[model samples]
Target: MAMGVHGRRGRGGRRAPMAEINVTPLVDVMLVLLIIFMVTAPLLATGVPVDLPQSRAAPLDQQAKPTQVSLDAQGRIFIDDAPVAEAALPQRLADLAAAPAPPEGRRVYLRADRSLDYGRVMRVMGELNRAGLNHVALVSTGEDQP
Candidate 1:
């Protein structure tokens, strides 16, 4: 007779060290997430919220650095970082057009403070439209309750 304890198999199969990091799947998932964010990032913003006046206007198609027109709550107007008198808009647009480069396509972005009057917004838009800068986009903050 021999002692049975010495040669018995252990309680379970022997464990083996993991041989792979499996980074390919992780990298694929990360790359896909990065692409999704890059595609959607431009559609987001955060600031004082406003209910934008609605219109039947068609969406604009564009690919250029647009000229910006900003209106403060006090009804002051700024065009491309310079305060513009209400009367000088057309000439200013012309000046922008005369400047060098591919951005002079007469495109403009209109950003109005949420507290501003509708008539004021329309008036500024009208001025730029009359200046032959037919391409104008209203800038707005993303929907966020404050």
Candidate 2:
């Protein structure tokens, strides 16, 4: 019976060792990362969430980085993530623009919430103009202006 058992455990009965890598777990991990990025992509767009009014304007491609000024729904102003007093905004921006070494283009991108009053937006623009940082780009999400 022992000899019979040994005979039964021959090369024919042996299975091949698995040398190939199972990619299912790797694929699963990659899919999980993809989902995480997809979910957080919009949130990572920029700080101070704003429902930007849409525009049919062509996309801008430029070499220089612009200074960002974002206005939230509550009318709070942020200059590159730093909150600024409305009155102090002009001087601060002007000083920042002229500091250390001036950038290639003194362009300023204004990100304003769609629900904000037009006058408020204009006022901010006026302030930006006062700062002498005149090249402005109005950021929008491409939704038609309602």
Best by TM-score: 2
TM-score of 1: 0.52
What is the per-residue lDDT of model 2 for residues 23-76, given as tens digits with 9 covering 90 to 100? 999999999999999999988886675545756678788786778899999999
What's the number of clashes in each of the models?
A: 0, 0
Model 2, residue 32: distance off in Å is: 69
Against the reference, the lDDT scores of all candidates come to 0.77, 0.82
After superposing candidate 1 on the true structure, give the runs of residues whose Cα lies further than 4 Å from its correct spot. Answer: 1-50, 53-63, 98-104
lDDT of 1 by residue, 1-146 (tens): 78565433445854555567989999999999999999777766554463674444565577776788999989988987899987787788777756764644556789999888889999888877766677787877655545
**Which ranges of candidate 2 are over 4 A from the true structure?**
1-52, 100-104, 144-146
